[model samples]
Structure formats: C-alpha cells, structure tokens
Target: MLMNPRVLVIIPAFNEASNIESTVRAVVDAGYDYIVINDGSKDSTLDICRLNGINVLDLSQNLGIGGAVQAGHKYARHYGYDIDVQVDGDGQHDPKFIPLLVDEIVNGADLAIGSRFLSSTDGFKSTYLRRVGIKWLSFWLQLFTGRSIKDPTSGFRASGCRAIKLFCENYPDDYPEPESIATSLKAGLTVSEVPVRMRERQGGVSSIGGFSSVYYMIKVSLAISIACLTKRS
Candidate 1:
C-alpha cells in the first residue's frame, strides 16, 4: 500500500443548504480532508459552509453537476492529492464507504466507483425509473468498454492520480459519471466498482426529476455510444 495517502473528498453542492453541514461533518468525522464546491446556490449553502468553517470553492454561477465535479478534479490535481473521492452533498452517499473506494485505488484501480448493486446489503437502489435508466447505461457501458459496472451512474467514486489528471484535462460537462468511466477505460486506465451502502437524500430535490429522467436516459446513452467510437487520447 499507499501508506497514508493524501485523500481529498470533493462534495459538489447546489442549493443544498439544508444538507451541506452534516455532509461535511460526516467526511471530517471519517478523518479525511474535504472541499465543498458551492455551485452558485441561491440558497444559504455557501453561508452554511462558511459558518461551519468548511473548506469551500464558491462559484459565482451555476455550472451543473459535471462542471462542479470537474472543478473538484482540477483542485485535487493542483493540490497534489493522491486520491480524490466524489461525495454528493445531498447526504445520499455514506462517507464510511470512502475507505473502500480508497482501498481499491491502492490496489491499482485508476477509478473506483461505489456501487449499490454489488451486494445485497446496500440500503437503497434508487427509484424504479432511475434503476431502469441505470441498467440501460450499464448495458451500453459494458458493450463499449467490455467491462460490466453495477452502478455506472453512482456519484460516489474515487479517482487515482492518473484518472485525476485525465479529468483535469478534459471532463464531461453534462451527465458525466457514466461517460467518465468510458473515457477512463478508453484512455487505458483501470476502473473497478466496490459495493457501498447508500441512503435516500435527507433534503433537497433531485436534479433529475419526472420527465427529465427520460431526457437524461437518452442523453447519457448517446454520449456513451459516441465516447466508445471516439479514439482514445
């Protein structure tokens, strides 16, 4: 192993004022450094972070989830972090599973995704429609990369140095989680999935809701297909 690797937990928040403090506290309790990207939330997200004395990157305007996450990767690369873990600010991801993701990276995975379907113990598997969309994405990802991922759409993930560098250079701007996996594999990096328990969001609404799920499915499917055909850098 990676004896005492420098790990940074990147939490991207947008209008998650009600949940940011507890989320940061969970990461801190887990004994890891973390930074919250306040993606132009009109709510009191930034204020809560500041009040809690949490490290935060305050963006002036909304950049969506992908852009916010890309910013986190850039910070991880710039600050020389050995591992970067993406944890949602909505409290759905358990910080306890962070160590599992890090362990996979230590074992030589360039990217480690926290998968809910890897085991029966995972508390939540998301909505029925969401699960259907996730399964569709999983099929496409497997067909393209020749690798099967149980939770391709999971936001809770960790990236090694190589993966961080790749994302810093070029990251997907919309619906990134699944596409990023394909991109990393195409770039010849090792990716793995570790079983992790997840929970329903404690607060705030989902970014993808109602009919948007259909649009999200179509968009991410097309993106993965195109990514598979494109030549790797």
Candidate 2:
C-alpha cells in the first residue's frame, strides 16, 4: 500500500538536557521522521522536548540504551515503518549520514552500522584505550559471527524491516551495540559497515569514561560472546 519506505530516526535520551534540543533539531532539519525516547532522566530533558515540540516517548523509569532503543523499534514496527535508524542523543552521531545508512538498507543490508574507523577521515574516534578495546572486541566478534565490523560499539546504526522486527523481539540490554551486532549476524541477517565521521559530544558526560572504560570492555565483550552463543543455538 505504501509507495516509499518510511524511515524513523530513533534518538534515545537520558539526562541529555543540554544536547537533546540540538540533536532532535538536526534530525528534523535533515527531514526525517523521528521519535525521542526519554529514558527517565531526572533532568529537564522532557520539558525541553515538550517546549520545542519534539515527538517523544516518556519512559516511567530508566531503561538504558537497549531498552530505550527497543521501545523506539517497537513503535516503528507497530506503525509500519520500513526503516529504523538510531542516532544517539549525546550529540556524537551526525545526522547527515542517515541517508547513506538508509541507502545501504534499501539496497540490501539488514543492518548498516556507521563506522568511525572504516575511513581515513579526521573524525572523533573516542579515546585510545577505548579504541583498543573496540578492536579486541571486533576480533572476537569476527571469530563468532564471521563479520569484520570495524566499529562494533557504534550506536549509529540503521535497521531494515527484518532487523527491526528481530530487534524488537530480542534486543540486548545494558551495553548493547556490540552484542546486538553479534545477535544480528547469528540470526542470519546481513550486516555491513559504512564510513561515517562522528563528533565529540557537544555537552554532557559519557557513560563510559576513566576507569569505567575497563569495565565496559569486559562487560561488552562478555555480552557479545553470550549473544552469539545463545543465538547460535
């Protein structure tokens, strides 16, 4: 019944009051339909969204990234959106690359990840320690899924019809980006990485920083391994 694929940009915000408005505006200015999932921030994020007339879904409690993103996917699926793109609310993800990711999905990829390391562009590539962790995880992910994702932890990704449905049914919780990729590959979905230039967060603190980076590497690596093994069954 539809002539064109409907795209929904999902922005999961938690205590991103300082950056939510600008992030949402970028998506709006890019001319894509979007929904902001307010992940129970104790700040004025919800008020800002309301004041700016941004479309948002208010969660009763904090659901973390996975839960908030899943909520958006479920909404997209329910509304018959043909594509779902995730742009983080921390202002790290650039909206200009949305079309490129969507193009990959339209062509054939079920999941298209916007990879920061795939190209030789001068972009914000996180800290050195985090990059090391990402590469280590990437090696393990290739071992498990046979896919060489340059940026396994990239939250800037787009999912097509199949992936949107699959994720809505079984999405990972906690730190989910890498685990979600493993899950997709194990489920026989086509996953590809497209080069993208990301920026440093314009405002607010990152969830993973300092000593927490060590914890992130361990936890996400374990989660990816578990997702692959479980989905392999």
Candidate 3:
C-alpha cells in the first residue's frame, strides 16, 4: 500500500475554457492535489481556473501539449511530489481512474497508463481514424521495446518519482505520448497499463484534426523511432 503518498494531478490545458472547470471539479472531488498548466490558452481557461481558485501555472506562450506537461512535471519535482498523474483538461480522461494509476505506481511501476483498449469499456475508444493511428504507434512501440502497450497514445498516465524527474529534464516537444513511452522503456523503467473508461471531450476540438492526423502520425512515428535509437541513461 502507498502510505501517505504525495500524489499530484497535473492537468495540461490549451484553450479548453469550456471544459476546464468540470474537469477540475472531478479531480478535486477525487481527493487529490492538482494544478492546471494553462499552456498559453487564447481562451478564458486561465481566468476560469483563477476564478475557481484552482492552482494554475500560466505560461506566457503556447508550448504545445508536451511542453505544458513537462512544466507540470518540473513543478511536481520541485514540490517533492511522489507521484504525478497527467490528466487532460478536455474531460476525456476520467479522474476516477487516478487512484488505479497511482496504485500501479505503488505496486512498483515507474509509469502507469490508463488504457481504453485493455477492457470492454463502451464509448471509450476514440474515432476510427484515431484508433488506426494509435494501433500503428502501439505496434511500433511494442516492436521496439518488447512490451505490449495497447494504447500508446493515451494521455492519461501516472509517473513515479523517477519518471517525474526524468520527464522534468527531458520530454518531447510534440506528439509526446508515444515517444515518452519509448523513452521510459529505453531507460529501463517498468511501465504498466490499467484498464480505464474514458468519455468524449466535453468541449474544444482536438489539436489533431483532418489533415493534421496524417501529420501527427508521421511525426509521432519518427519521434518514436529516433527515441529508440538514442542511448539509455
């Protein structure tokens, strides 16, 4: 059992004004400390957080998802948090699974991912095209790392102290989810996946849409491949 663990939920938001409040509320109700990283949102995301008295880290410029999440990890490291869970501000990631991810960390996983494909949860799987991209990434990740990761692109994840520190020092700039998994594996960290239910985003469009999906797939694939070639620390 994890006794008195200092768990912190790091939410990375980018113009998610319509969804941030309810997402923060769910996290608050789940009884964990949280901080929202406002990644230079053009919308009222930062204002909403401030109005709700939510702890927030407002960046001066947009840093994409990777930079936003990295900032959160840096904060976790500075504050001495034992575990850091990445929950999206778009409400697609359910806060209820935060404990399960934390439990995996307590059980000795360096990183724990909330996977939608690990179970028969309805309405959790993303769109067909997105799933295709996810599957492609998953296959490459498993082939390179010798580990089965059903949902390599999942943003819902928890990291232990070691991972938090590593991520603070080095994290991808774009399409980070899959590349981060490869990095963890190359570093010899134990990664686990927990079955979790997800919901459609309450608001805001995905950053990767239409033609962006093709770009996203190619970019992530190259990132993962390059990460696999780098020497492990």
Candidate 4:
C-alpha cells in the first residue's frame, strides 16, 4: 500500500489500450496514488491496468464521463484521499504538471484547474464551434462567479474532498468538467487555474471524431448553460 496518497489521480479511460499503461506509469513515477476507472472498455484497457498493478475501479456498464469520474470520487472518499486530480485517458493531459496543481491545492485552493490559455507557452486546438462554445460558457461563468476562469472546460483539474463531495452527490451526467467548475465556485470553493500543456492522443480516433463532434459541441454547450441556470449562486 502507498503511504498517505494525498492526491488521488483519477483516469477515466474508455478503450485506452495504447496509452493506459504509459499514463499509469507516469502517475506512478510522479509518486501520487491513482485510480484508473475503466468504463467498460472492450479493448485491452482493463487488462493492461491489471497487468501493471495499478489501482483500478471497474464498471459493469459504460457510464460515460461523469459516471467514471464519480466512481473515482467515491473510491477516493472511501480510501481517505484528500485530493482528486482528473487526467484524461487519451494522453491529452501531461503528468509532469501534477505537482503544480497539487501544490496549489495544498496551499488552500479547493480546485486547481490546468488552463492552456493562462500562459504564453500553452495552446488550444479544435473547431470554430468548440472554441466558440468555450468562450460562450466562459462568459456566463465569469459573470456568475465574479472571477475570470482561464480555462473552464479543461479536464486537467484537481479537486479537494469538499469539492469532490459536491460532485459525487449531484454532478451532471455528461460533459461534467466544465459544469463542475461552476458548481465548485458557487458552492464557495476556491478555484484557481495554472498554465499547462496538452499532448495529442495515442490510440483510437475520438468517439467524437466525425460529425459527432458538432453534436457533442451542441449538447455539452446546452448542458453547461442549463446546469448553470439551475445551480445555486
């Protein structure tokens, strides 16, 4: 057993055979406890995680992004981890930045969001609609929180127990990372964003690679807006 895993890294992987092992190794190398939530991947994802002896949480059925993340939160709470750092399965989030986020959280922030737009060295890629979507929600987010969030939708975020409790109890079922940020702020959690770089994917075209990308943008954007309206300020 690892000693007092203060930061619990949650990787919600769906068919990440090509990158899961490397990601788990990186988290181990970073010296933080991690849980790989295998969301019913049909590929070798679960096998690879098991072979590596990584801490894992398996689901009988695919629960989408929110469910996978909530599983990690429950595990962390049960195990008594103080913080939860969510890293994507496809290698988009760099493991090297884990310490920066953890340090910020330890210093008192309830959530440390790794923002690609906060520093001069970082960058963002995607279609015009996605960019527009980020900007549109970001506008309302700032208005609601009275703080300008450098990256509202980045999956590379770290949350503490207080924030994790809120999420596991009433998190949005889809496209949750962005919506959770707002919820975190409204619930009086201190949220900060630091500069971080992203890597390209390693295997399998994104489930949203084709025309589904447009549909994802529309759906998530609407979900974010609606969730914001109903959440308490």
Candidate 5:
C-alpha cells in the first residue's frame, strides 16, 4: 500500500439542511479534508454550511445525488487527491468507518464500499422492502460483473485514483449508487466491501421513500443493466 495517500471526503446533499451540519461536523472531527456539494438544496443547507464555515460547492440547480457526487470527484481530481471518500449528507453513513474504506483503497481496491450487510449485527438495515430491492439489484450486479457485493446501494464508499477518474468523467445522474457499481466493474476496476455500522437518518427525509422506493428499484435495476451493456472506451 502507498504511504500516506491524500484523501478527500465528498458529501453530496440536496434538501438536507437539518442533517448536513452534523454530518459535516462528524467528518471534520474525523480529521479528513472534506467538501460539501450543495445540490441546489431548496432548504437552507447551503446557508448552514456557510454559517458553519464548512467547505462547500454550491450548485445553481439541483442535479440529484449523481451530479453532486460527480462534482465532488471532479474537485478531488483537480486538487490532485489520491483518494476520495463519499459520505451521505443525511447522517446515515458514519464517518468513523471512513478509515476502513480508505484502507481498502490504499490496499489496491479501486472502489471500496462500506457494506452494512457485511456486518451480521448492529446497523440500520433499512426497511424490509428496501432490503429486498437491494438484494435483487445485488443479484443482477453480480451476474453482470461476476463480483459479489452485499451492499450495492451503499453510498458510503471510497474510490482510488482509477475509480475517481472514471466517475469524474462519466457518472450516472439518476439513482446512481447501485448503477455506479456496475460502471466501476465494467471498467475493470477492483471493487471490495468492508463491514460498517450505520445509523438511521438523523433528520430530513430520505430521497428514496414510500412509493418512490418502487421507482428506485426499477430505475436502478434498469440503469445497472444498461451500464453492463455499454462498452467502455
């Protein structure tokens, strides 16, 4: 493993004013350099970040999670960071496990995902329906990529230089968490997962909730399928 790789934490948020502050604070407390991409939050998320003196990139319009995260990757790349770690703004992902993800990257994993399912106990596993949806997606992803990832929908992940450059250039925009995994594997990147405990959202509503959960499953499944078929240049 390379010694002392420069790492940046990327927090993408949209309408997460209630939880963004605490989330950023946790990352800061963890002693990692971070940037918050305020994805045109209609809420006061940007204001909260500015008020707290957090490093932020304000988007003029909301571009969903995919766009926000891609913006972060671009920033990391421009700043010449060796690794980039993504932590959700809703506080579902814990910053303490960030080192584990980064360690996997340093050990040669192109993409290291923080998987709750990898742990047998103590984590917010989401709703049963959501878990079912995640499982279905996982099955398909494994079939296509020939890799088994327990939490393909996880947003808590770390990317090495290869994955960072791939995402910076071409990232999915709609319901991207699961689909991005397919993209990473298709590009011949090494994907691995580590066990991590996550808490329920501290505040604000999840972007995928209620009936949209169904849409999320279908949309992400389709995106993953398409990603498998697309030839990488």
Candidate 6:
C-alpha cells in the first residue's frame, strides 16, 4: 500500500505479459495505488493481473494507448483517487522517479512529465527525424497553449483530478502524441516536466518503423496542426 494513499499510478499495457509482473512489483515497491489498463491484449495479460491480484481495467478490444490511459482517468474520477500517473507497460519507464512526481503534485502542478530529452540521458534514442518532429509539435503547442513542453510525447507523466477530468472527456484515440499535451494545456491545467530515467524496451518491438515512421510523422504533423488551429471551447 502507498504511504501516501492518495497518489495513484496507472500503467496502460498491451501484450506486456513478460514485463507486467516485475513492473507491478517495482511500482508497488515505490508505494503507489497501481492500476493497470489491459487494452485488449491477446496474451495472458488479464490472467497475469488476476493472478497477481492487482487492480485492473480490461477492455474487450484494443483501444490503443490513448484509450487505455483515458480509461484509467475515468477510473480515478469514479473511485475518487486524488492523484494519477502514467507509466509505460514495456518497463521503459523507471519507478525511481515516482517520488519526484509525488512531490510535484503535492507542490501544486496538475501534470508532472518525465522527460528523457530534458537533459543528456544515456541508453535511449529518439532518432533525428523524430526529434525534428517533436520540436515541430512542441513549437505548435507553445504557440497554441503558450507553455514550453520539453517532451510532449512522453508516456511517463503524472496528473491530478484537473487533468483526469479533461482527459476522461477528450483524449485522442490512436497515435496519441503531443496533441494530448495541447489539449491538456487548453484545459487550463498546470503542466511541468521533471527529469526521469528511461530504459530501452525489455521485450516486444515497436509498431512504428520503416515506411510506417514516415506515415506516422505526416499523420501526426497534420493532426497537430489541426489541433493547434482550433481553440477548445
């Protein structure tokens, strides 16, 4: 159980059977109300959650990363959990930084992001093209939201009730990237970036690669452009 019971960490996982157990144990060690969103994983993901007796919200079909996370937000609202964090299921997000996030939330930020690119972090790569794309999106977010976001696409982040309510109502479905950052900022929630360590994936392969990378960049760029132009009402 968490020493600070109000803080929750929501891990959105899909087909991460090999990494889930260790991930859960580590986060529990860090002391958090850990909730896992099994996004219709085809493997024994749900079984693993059940066997471990962990809090889980299982979906009937794949809802992508955005849906999994937003579902967790909905859970927070329904259960009245005061604070929530997002960590990757592939074990890339380190649990060592959970304390820092908790402190940030306690200090008054609505969202605390673990940014790998905030400084020189070793053993991780975002590629040049991806970095360019990130900068492009960041510029747009800054323009629209008037806030500097270091890692807009970062999956490792913490959010309080302010962000949870916004995301529960409006989050992207697929290829959720910096656009979510824009949406969060538009909602008038406080957002900040904290330095955190990230490791390479322990298992499985990335879905965005080869020609898909180019397509993803183009699609996301267009989506971000569209998002920036419209002011959220």
In model 3, which runs have C-alpha deviations exceeding 4 angstroms? Answer: none
Residue-wise lDDT of candidate 3 within 114-219, one digit each (tens)? 9999978685699888998888998998888888899999999999988998899889999899999999999888899999999998999899998898899999
The model with the greatest lDDT is: 1
Predicted structure 1: lDDT: 0.93
What C-alpha lDDT do the candidate models reach, one value each?
Answer: 0.93, 0.92, 0.93, 0.81, 0.92, 0.81
- Which runs in model 5 stand beyond 4 Å of their true positions? none
Q: How close is candidate 3 to the true structure, as a TM-score?
A: 0.97
Comparing 4 with 6 on TM-score, the higher-scoring candidate is 6
RMSD in Å for model 3:
1.1
In candidate 4, what are the lDDT values of residues 119-225, reduced to their tens digit?
Answer: 67735444566677678667767776577886787889888778888877877667777778877777788999888887667666677656776676677666656
**TM-score, one value per model:** 0.98, 0.96, 0.97, 0.89, 0.97, 0.90
Cα lDDT over the full model 4: 0.81
Q: How many clashes show up per model?
A: 0, 0, 0, 0, 0, 0
Better of 2 and 4 by TM-score: 2
Q: After superposition, how far is residue 30 of candidate 4 from its true place, in Å?
A: 1.0
Clashing pairs in model 4?
none
Model 2 C-alpha lDDT per residue in residues 3-106, reported as the tens digit of each score: 36899999999999999999999999999999999999999999999998999999999998899999999999999999999999999999999989999998
Candidate 5 lDDT over 23-137, as tens digits, reads 9889989999999999999989999989989899999999989999999999999999999999999999988899999999999999999999999877899988889988998
Q: For candidate 5, what is the lDDT? A: 0.92
Candidate 6, residue 210: Cα displacement in angstroms equals: 2.2
Ten-residue stretch with the least lDDT total in model 5:
205-214
Question: Looking at candidate 6, what is the lDDT of residue 77?
Answer: 84
